[model samples]
Target: MSTATLINLVRNGGYQVRRRAVLTSRLLQDEKRPTAACYSSTSERRASRFDPDGSGRPTTWDTFGIWDNRIDEPILLPPSIKYGKPIPKVSLANVGCASHIGKRKENEDRFDYAQLTEDILYFAVYDGHGGAAAADFCDKYMEKYIKEFLAEEENLENVLNKAFLEINKAYERHAHLSADATLMNSGTTATVALLRDGIELVVASVGDSRALLCRKGKAMKLTIDHTPERKEEKDRIRKCGGFVAWNSLGQPHVNGRLAMTRSIGDLDLKNSGVIAQPETKRVQVKKGLLNRDSNIRTKGHHRYLMQVALPT
Candidate 1:
C-alpha cells in the first residue's frame, strides 16, 4: 500500500481491530505486487476493514491481538522528551506548566486537561520517544474512551484503565495495517490525573513521567516512574527474554534501547514487558487540612496541590 493509503488506514481504523488477521494476510500476499490491480476484486476491497462477527464492529479488547512475533526495530534520533508550557503562576487546581524544546529537533510531549463538571477535572501528560505517533494517538483518543467507559462504570479507576487499554489497542491495530506501518517504531509514556471539586486527585501513570502532590506545604510524590532499573521491571524484562544494559550516561534501558519498563504503544517492545497498564492511585481529599492524615502520613493543613514537570 502507498504511504498515504497506509496513513489513511491508520487514521480511519481507530479501535477496529477484528480485521487484523485478514490485514496481515493481505499484506503478505498483495503488498508486493506492482499494480493497483493487485487487490483484485471489489469484494476484497470491501472486506479490508472486516466486521468479523457480523455485528459490524470489533468485539471486546481481548480479541484486538496486540501481541505478535514480529520485531523490526528502527534506529531513533536524539530524544526530545523535554517540552512544557509557560508557568502560569496559578494554583495547582488552575495550574500552568512551562515547556521548552531542548536541543532535539522534535518535541514529543503532549498535555491536556478538561473540566467535566464544576467540581471535576481531567489532566494528562505524555512523554514520547522514538516518534510521535503513539503519543499523538493517545492524546487524540484517550478522553473519548474515558468518557465512554465512565458512562458504563461509576468507578473512575476502572474507567482510566479501560481507556488506556482501548487507546493502545486502537493504535496497535493502526500501526500494523497495510498503511501506517511506520507507527510501530514509536511509543510513549502516559500520565493522567483526574481531579474532583478541586479536592480529590486520582492519577494513572505508565512509564517515567512523574506526578507529585503537594499538601500543607509538604511534597508527596503521587506516581512512580517506570524505569527499567527498577527491580520488578528488570526481573519482568528478563523473564520475557529481553535484556537490560546501561547507556554511557549510566541510565539503564530495556533491551539497551528504551529506558522505561512500561508505556502506551511500544509495540516492538511488548514481548519484553513494556505494557500499557497504568499504575493507578487515588488520594483521599478532605476539605480541611489536618496536622496529619492517614493517607498522606504528614502533618499539615488540607491543601491539595500538584507539581508536574517534564523529563530532564
Candidate 2:
C-alpha cells in the first residue's frame, strides 16, 4: 500500500490549535484582554510551546499564555491501529511545524491535520485576510464539518465542497449573532486534503493556499489559486456586477476588494461572485511509487513540511 504524508503552510504563519470549534466564541472574546492578562498564570514564566527545549513544559491549555490557541502536540488519531486497520502512520519525530509573526501584529494563518477515521487522514491550511477571525473560524470548524459530512458521504470531493459552503454560512451566522459587522468582511483561503485507505488522495481548495506533492524528485501542484487571474473566476465576478481592480502592488482583487475569487466567511463579498465552493482534485497513490523518497508540502504565508515513509 502507498503511504501519504501532509504538510501545511499558512501565508502569514502556521500553528496548530488543539482545541475544538466550540471554543471559538470564548477565544475571540478573550482577545480583548491585556497581553499580561491573557496568560492563565502569573507566577512562573512558561516556556514557549514551540520551543525545542523540554524544560518548563506547559501543563495546561494556558501554556502559551496567549490569546491564540497554539498547541505543540498534534491531535492524534483514534485507536484504529489497535482495531487492525491498515493506515498510514505519521511519526511525531518526522513531522514538524514553524511560524513567524512577520510584519503583521499577529499571525493570521492557521493549519492542522488529524486522522478523521480509521481509513482517512485529514490535512488543511487556512489564510486569513482582513482579520484572523475568518481564518480562525475555518481552522476550528473545517475539519469538524468534513468529519460530520463524511458520516453520510462517500465521496471526498463532495464532502469537502459541502464543508466549505457550510462553514461559510455558519461563519456568517456566527458574525451576525456576535453583532460584529466588521466580521462580515473577514475572509480566508482554505486548502484541505484527505488521504484514505493509505492510497486515495483528494484535495479541495479555495483561494491561493497551495498543496504540492513531491514524488521521484519531481514536484506536482495539486490545487490552483482562485483569483481574478483565472478567466472563469474573473468572468464570474464580472457577471455578478463585481469589477476586478489592481492595487499599487499590481495584484488583482475582486471588486477592488478580496484577492481571491472564492473564500470562506467573506459574507460581504457573496453577492460579488466570491463563493466558498472549492475546486477539487483526486489522485490514487500507487504502492512503492510513493515512499520515504516522497514528501508533501503546502503553503500560504508560512511553510509546514511533512515527510512520508512507506514500506516497499
Candidate 3:
C-alpha cells in the first residue's frame, strides 16, 4: 500500500488491478488521507510509464531524452575547416526531455545540433508551438544550413544570420503543398550560443526560449527575451494587427497566446506580417590587465588565459 511498493508494482506492470481496487476501496471507505496518497502514487506511476526500471534512463518517449547517451559520441570535424594554432580542448553535452505536463505523444521542443571549436562552442534550443512539423523540420535542416553557410561565408556573424534566413525560406517552400499545411502555422523559439576564444560569447535568439551563460562564477544572460509586453515588442505586434494581453500571472503575451515576439515558421502569424527573426548579440571576455580593469574578475590568472583556438 506504500508509494514505493505501488511504484514497483506499476513498473512491473503487475499492479493495475490491485491499484484500482485499492483506490476504489479507499474512496468507498471515505478515507481522505489514504485516498490522497493513493492518488499521488497513481500519478507517479503514470509519469514513470516510459521508464519502467526507474533507473532515470530516458526512453524514446521522452523527447528531450534523445541527447542523453549520445553525448559520448566522438567529435567529427569537416575536412575543409582548418584548425587554428594552439587548439583548445573541447567537450559538449546536451539533454532534451519532454515537458511533464500537457498532452502526451508530442514534443514541442527540438534540438538539432551541438558543435564545439577551439574558439567557439555552438548549441541551439528550439521550442516549437502549434505543432511538431516546423520544429521537426528545423531539427533536421537547421544544422545543414549552418554548415553550408559556414563553408561559403568567412564571417561568423554573417554566416549565422544567413543560416536562419535560409531555414525560413526552406520552411516556406515546404509549406506550399496542401499536404504540409500543418507546417504553415507551426513555429518554434530558437536560442543559440557561440562561445568565442573560450572567452567572448555571442547569443542569438527568437521567441521566448532562453539561453543563460555562466561566466566568472556568475550567471550572465546573453540574449533578451522578445516578449509582447516590452514596448518594442508591443509596437511590432500592434503594427501587425496583433494584440497583446496579460495572463493570470500578469505576463503579457502575443495575441493573448504566445509570449515571444519573433520565431521561425508560424506561417499564419507571418502572413499577418509578424516575421520571426533571431536577435543576435556578442559578449567579449576580456583578459590580462583589462580583465581586472573591466570588473571581469576570475578565480585564477592562468585559468583565465586563452588555452588555444581550434581551427574551424
Candidate 4:
C-alpha cells in the first residue's frame, strides 16, 4: 500500500499499531524509501515536536525510564521443547517510535514504550475519545500499574488483565476526586504488549487499536478490535440492556454513542456491556527473526504519522 493510504486508514479509525519489517541488503540499497518518521498527505508536512531535550529538533529516541545498558543482554534459554530452537538476544536499540497531532485540535493519542524490568519490555498505545483525559491517565499510570501488578503476578497475561481493570477503577477515582462528571464519559482504546525473555510476546487490548507483526514480509495480527459490529460484542451489549445503532456513516455504535464496545473509561456504558477487561494473546518470536534487522512503528490519527526505522 502507498504510505498515504496507510495514514488515511489510521485516520479513519484503523490503526497500524505495530509493524515489523526485515531489511535485507537489497532493501537497504533503496535510498528513495522513507525513514520511520511521519510525512503528511498534504503539502505542509512538518516534523513532530516530541523533543525531550531542548535541542530544537524532533526526537529520534526516548528511553522512558532509567537507561540500563545491561537490559540489552539477551536471555540464555535452552532450546524450546516444542520448536527445538534456541532463543536469540534482541536489542532494544532496534525499536523506534513517533507520533503526530493529526487533524484534531488537540492530540488525544498517548503512547509509551520502555523497559519495565531487566527481563520485560513494555509498549502501549492509548487513543482517547470525548477528551484527552482518559488517554493522558493511561499514558501516565498504565506502566506504573503494570509494574505494580507484576510484583504479584507471574504470568504476563494476568498482569495485563489486572492492570487494565485497576487502571479503569483508578481513573474513576481520579475523576470523582476531580469532581468532573464529564470525565466519566471520556474513554480510550488500550493496546499493550509485553515482551518477556526476549521471545514471548503477550498482548492485551480493548477497543480498536491493533498490533501487527511482520515476519518474513508477512503480517501477523496480534489483537482484535472490540466494536459493536462484532457479533459477539453486539450480543453482549444487547444482553446487558443496550442496543446498537448505526450512524450516518454506517458505523455501528453502542446506544448510539461510543463506537467501541469495550474501553478503559466510558463508565456511563458499564451497565450496557462496555468493559475494561482486555482480551489477551501470546506468541513467540522466532530466534531467526530477532537475529535479522527488524522495525517497529505506531500510528496516530491519519492526519499524523510516525515511523522509526532501525538501521542494522
Instruction: Report the error of model 4 at residue 192, Å.
Output: 0.4
- What ranges in model 1 sit over 4 Å off? 1-93, 117-119, 288-312
lDDT of 2 by residue, 123-174 (tens): 7788888989999998888889998999999999999999988998899889
Compare candidates 1 and 4 on lDDT and give the better one.
4
Error of 2 at 255 (Å): 1.6
Q: What is the lDDT of residue 183 in candidate 4?
A: 95
When 1 and 2 are scored with lDDT, the better candidate is 2
Enumerate clash totals for all models, in the order shown. 13, 4, 7, 3
In model 1, state the lDDT of residue 209.
80
The ten-residue window of minimal lDDT in model 3 covers 297-306
Cα lDDT tens digits for candidate 1, 1-312: 899999889876863565786787777766565555365576553321234333334555434433121112221111111111111111234345545556558878777667654445677788777888988888888888887886798777888889888898898898888386668879988888876543456888898887766555566777888887689888989999999999999999898989888898889989888888999999854322121221222110111122432111
Q: In candidate 2, how many Å is residue 196 off?
A: 0.4
Tell me the tens digit of each residue's lDDT in model 3 across 1-312: 999998997876756777888978876665343424334454343434466444345666533443332323233333112332122233443222233324546656655435644445666667777887777777788777777876677666776778777898888888886585677778877666565544455667777665554445465655677777668878878887888889999987777766677888877777444565677877654432222112211111011111112212
Q: Where does model 2 exceed 4 Å of error? A: 1-93, 289-293, 302-312
Question: Each prediction's TM-score against the native?
Answer: 0.62, 0.68, 0.58, 0.69
Comparing 1 and 2 on TM-score, the stronger one: 2
Answer with 1 or 3, whichever has the higher TM-score.
Answer: 1
